[model samples]
Target: MGFESVSDFLAMGGHGLYVWLSYAIALVVVVLNLIAPLRTKKQIHKEQARRLRREQSQI
Candidate 1:
C-alpha cells in the first residue's frame, strides 16, 4: 500500500477528512494539555504575588 504522490497519501483512500480531522483534534488536545498546566501555574503565581503585596502594604 504505497502512495505515488503526496495528494494520494493525504487522501487516505477517500477517508482523508476523518483521518486529518482526528489528527488535528488530537494535536490540539495535546497542545492544550501542555499549556493548561503552565497557564494555571502562572495564574497561581500572580495571585500569590498579589496577596503578598497586600500583606506587606498592611505592615
Candidate 2:
C-alpha cells in the first residue's frame, strides 16, 4: 500500500483495468440499491395521496 503516486496506486500492480472496473461496478450497484428504495417510496406516497383524494371526493 506504499505506492509513490496516485497513478501507481490506481495501477494496482498492473491490474488497473480489472480493479477499476470492479470498483465502478460495485459503486453502481450500491448507488442503485440506495436509489431504488427512494423511488419506490415516492411511488407509494403518490398512490396513497391519490387514494385519499378519491375517498375525499366521494364524501
Candidate 3:
C-alpha cells in the first residue's frame, strides 16, 4: 500500500539490497539447518550399516 508499484516495493526506500540480502542469508541458513540433519542421519546410517556388516563378517 505504501509503494506505488512492484519496482517501488522492491526498492524498499533504498534499503532493498540490505533487506533482500538478509532474507537470502536467512533462507540459506534455514535450508542448511534442514539439510544438515538429514545428511548427518544418512551418514550415521551408513556407518552403522558398515559396522554391522563388519561384525557379521567376523562371525
- Candidate with maximal TM-score: 3
lDDT of 3 by residue, 1-59 (tens): 49999998998999999989999999999999999999999999999999999999999
Per-candidate Cα lDDT values, in order, are 0.98, 0.97, 0.96
Q: What is the per-residue lDDT of model 2 for residues 1-59, given as tens digits with 9 covering 90 to 100?
A: 79999999899889999999999999999999999999999999999999999999999
Candidate order by lDDT, decreasing, is 1, 2, 3
Model 1 C-alpha lDDT per residue in residues 1-59, reported as the tens digit of each score: 99989999999999999999999999999999999999999999999999999999999
Worst 10 residues of 3 by lDDT: 1-10
Roughly what TM-score does model 3 have, to 2 decimal places?
0.96
User: Candidate 3: deviation at residue 16, Å?
Assistant: 0.4
Q: Lowest-scoring 10 consecutive residues by lDDT in candidate 1?
A: 1-10
> Number of clashes in every candidate structure?
0, 0, 0
TM-score ranking from best to worst?
3, 1, 2
Best-performing candidate as measured by lDDT: 1
- How many clashes would you count in candidate 2? 0
Query: Where does candidate 2 stray beyond 4 Å?
Result: none
